[model samples]
Target chain A: MTDWDGRRWHDMGGQAAGPVPMESHDFALWEKRVDALMVLCGQKGLFTVDGLRRALEDMGEEAFETYSYYERWIAAVNQNLIEAGVYATEELAARMAEIAARGPTYGEAQDG
Target chain B: MPHDHPDHDHDHHDHDHDHDHGPFHHEGMSPSGHPYRHDNDSPLTYWQRMEIAVRELLIDKGRITAAEIANQIEAMDARSPTNGAAVVARAWTDPAFKARLLHDASAASREMGFDIGPLNLIAVENTADTHNLIVCTLCSCYPRNLLGLPPDWYKTRAYRTRAVREPRAVLREFGLDLPANTTVRVHDSTADMRYLVLPARPAGTDTLTERELAALVTRDSMIGTGLPLRP
Candidate 1:
């Protein structure tokens, strides 16, 4: 309690949020890919797990609140890649635009 | 408005501030001489799409392979609470093992064959007078190497915020009502370290096999947010 900043999102606990649910959850395809990509890149020395955590922490409050848990991981991965010069931000935008034009053909009907 | 969309989109206007072009001049963050578009016919964000683009680029660059990424994903998917379950069951059955686990969770887990990755994992024990809980307030810093990914709510703003402010209340909401004198200690997982709770063995289970006992240990119990099932 000497010099701790309790205002941040990660340090928050024990405040109050009603009864927690015990529901079972399954990961989506993109989420699973994000987790694996983060680990693979980490093993490749692209960045550390701590680096991703710090990147997630540095996000603006708006983005921080908006993205889900796995979505945040993807964002962190993207940030690291862009920072590492793996691709230019312009390059990413163009790729995204191209994909969007091609339409949402994401999941390959694995389960859904 | 983008707000009306479920994805909480902000559109190309947000990036408009950084570039000099007003209507359609371009050269902001993307540097393509054109303003960014929200014509994303899908539910993906700029970041999510970036995830795909970057991953594909990495694969194409020979830095990583699609098969490698797929294998990693498969390995992660194969992990569940069962790894934690077996560890807790062994600790419950053997005093020496329990001590070993409490002394060094990562090594003990490795002894059982589940690679604990590079992070430090400390196993907190729950006794008659004290209980333990783990949370990553800044992000969902969980014991992924041992427990796979965490639950959605565990990373929610509500749980993250409240779990620190009122641990007992949050636990009670999860139906864990500790005694007034019981000391509830919450472990906030940071970047370099993670935690798993070695919940006390339930009563009347001495006759169960290690496998059966292991089956009783749910993901939430190891996280200290739920108690093991009584078998």
Candidate 2:
């Protein structure tokens, strides 16, 4: 309860957060990997966990709720990577474009 | 995938709308053997694509080896709720261990041979007069070393916002109907520290062994959404 910034959304203590369901679903393969990726990056001195939290905090509100849990992790890690000079933003865009051009290959491959 | 960062400052960065993508396919870019989940909309998700490029680029730059990343992944895979369950079970049977757990949770975990990572771990005991609930209202700042990654429900908007403001009601909805006189204390994990709820030992388990008692400790019990089973 102490040291919470009143204006921050994440500092929500004793706020009307939402309903707490008693169950949880299985984490998808990619979703499970994000933790390790982040830990590895952190262990390499690339960025701190606090830095990653800042990046997550910096995300747009809609984006915060829009993507799945690890999707946000991927975005936050990507942001930190580019900011840390470990990867170029331009390269990321280029690679994304390259894969996008491949045109959803899984369906076609599965059919063949 | 929806993070279209407004600060993405590139004059030529119309990476979104450019449709005249070339028919070029890099030699090793075959979809058949790539490390990707089969999403119908796109073979490789935006995040998967980014991971590949960033992972490769980091490797190319001599920043991190693929082995280290693999090792970390293996470590994460090895972690589970059993780590927390063992800790809680020991505290339930042994009063001295319970004192140590409440005093310094991470050290107590380390004493039990569980690596609790770098963040401080605090064990808040739930007593008859007081109940403790943990939440990371911002993001899912869980004690992964103890309980692994948080369950999907823990990261939901409702849980994040409601855990602090309406804990009693939220807990009730989770099937934890507390006594009206019990004061609920919702711990907000704002920083690096993570909180674990050492739920009150249920009655009639005095004869149960540590391993047998650990079986009664559910993941939600440690999260304070539910209580340990009564045996």
| CA displacement after TM-score superposition, residue B216 of candidate 1 (Å) | 1.3
Candidate 2 displacement at residue B101 in angstroms:
0.9
The reply for model 2, stretches above 4 Å from the true place, is A1-6, A13-18, A21-23, A98-112, B1-42
Whole-model lDDT values for every prediction: 0.73, 0.71
lDDT of 2 by residue, A4-94 (tens): 5556665545556434544443443345446667887897889988888888877857767576666778888888989998778888788
Q: Cα deviation of B93 in candidate 2 (Å)?
A: 1.8
TM-score of every model?
0.81, 0.80
User: What lDDT score is found at residue B88 in candidate 1?
Assistant: 97
Q: How many residue pairs clash in all the candidates, one count each?
A: 17, 10
Chain A: TM-score in each model: 0.79, 0.79
Docking class of 1: acceptable
